[model samples]
Target: MSDDQLFALANALPLVGWLALCLAPLARPALVASARVVAAAMAVGYAVMVGLALARAGGPAPDLTTLSGLARAFSDPHVMLVGWVHYLALDLWTGAWEAEDAGRRGVPHWLLLPCLALTFLAGPIGLLLFLGVRTLPGRRVPARP
Candidate 1:
């Protein structure tokens, strides 16, 4: 496939995968079951896409398919995905922690779902949105006795 095709494919798979997860509750008997399926599918798809990108980037040989393939993949894709993934992962982790910390905050789960979706679509944007929404301004009120 051409670079354009690969780039399109790279972006489409994660977006579609997240959309699948977002809609899975309506399609399955159990939310946990749906989540597991979506997560597995996305992980595999992401791995393959990254590998292909690295190969196309001219860092490594495509034949390297295992952990041993790293030296090869590292040569081309330039590890660009790693930094994004790291940022996304940390953002999600902290978001969850902040949600837990909001004892009386009672933030809705729906509010978080979109942020999680965006993180996978574009890491930095998703993370910033998450933080911003979490810290949204509150209504002003007079002090109580």
Candidate 2:
């Protein structure tokens, strides 16, 4: 795919995922499942694109006008930010999934909410926040054998 097409697709992912999630309440279980699968696939594709950008490293990048030229785009802030947003969206979606999973597992919902918000705003910050929240001030207990 061309650069423009790739960028457009990358940009569309979060919107598409959000739309599906938003519509899920009225959809059948199978429909919701299909939405989730599409969201997950989009997230994975976003990640692979990120890896490709890192590999390119700010050199003469792809033209995006041609399928073969898509990987040729240089590593620039614009591209990086687009990739970052994709990462954030994926990260948030994963957090949402985890929150649902945690509910199924009987973990508290409160624990997941803040992390989700943090990641939604900025991907790395959510992880940092989670780690910060997880670290207790109390003394560490000895490991049980």
Candidate 3:
């Protein structure tokens, strides 16, 4: 498939997981499992794209060390797609964890919905919101094994 088509697929893959997270609190296990599957699929795509980027002829190897080097590396659409998929996979994975963790901790599902939405849109910010919610008095529950 073309990179643009792959990009569209990658973007769409996590929406179901996110929607389930927000709307299906009772099906936490299934939701989490589905999120894992989606993230894994995205991760496989990411790995293949990375390998392709590395193997492509006549381009400087992707540089993650310096800001300018990183910018230059991401100038390639393939590398950008890899980065986008990385974010999609990890953010959706994080939202799944947040949903599971919040459910375990007895945090209200209503409270978690915003956090999940934030995580879907802006990963760390949503995590930060969830972490803050976890600190409220009486929100604590023993960590999962």
Report clashes for each candidate as comma-separated counts: 3, 8, 0
Candidate with the larger lDDT of 2 and 3 = 3
- Which pairs of residues have clashing backbones in candidate 2? 2-64, 3-64, 58-75, 61-72, 61-73, 61-74, 62-72, 62-73
RMSD of each: 9.7, 9.1, 1.7
Per-residue alpha-carbon lDDT of model 3 for 15-44, expressed as tens digits?
977877876477888878888788888888
Full-model lDDT for every candidate? 0.49, 0.56, 0.86
Off by over 4 Å in 3: 140-145
Error of 3 at 58 (Å): 3.2
RMSD of 2: 9.1
Query: What are the per-residue Cα lDDT tens digits for candidate 2 across 1-145?
Result: 7667766776666555544433443443443455466667766776777787668666554587975555444255557555665674566465445444433343334665576567656667876775555453542334446
Candidate numbers sorted by lDDT from highest down: 3, 2, 1
Against the hidden reference, what TM-scores do the models get?
0.37, 0.43, 0.91
Q: In candidate 1, which residue ranges exceed 4 Å CA deviation?
A: 24-42, 45-109, 121-145
Cα lDDT tens digits for candidate 1, 103-140: 22433456656766666556567667766766656622
Worst lDDT 10-window in candidate 2: 100-109
Q: Model 2: runs farther than 4 Å from truth? A: 54-82, 88-92, 95-145
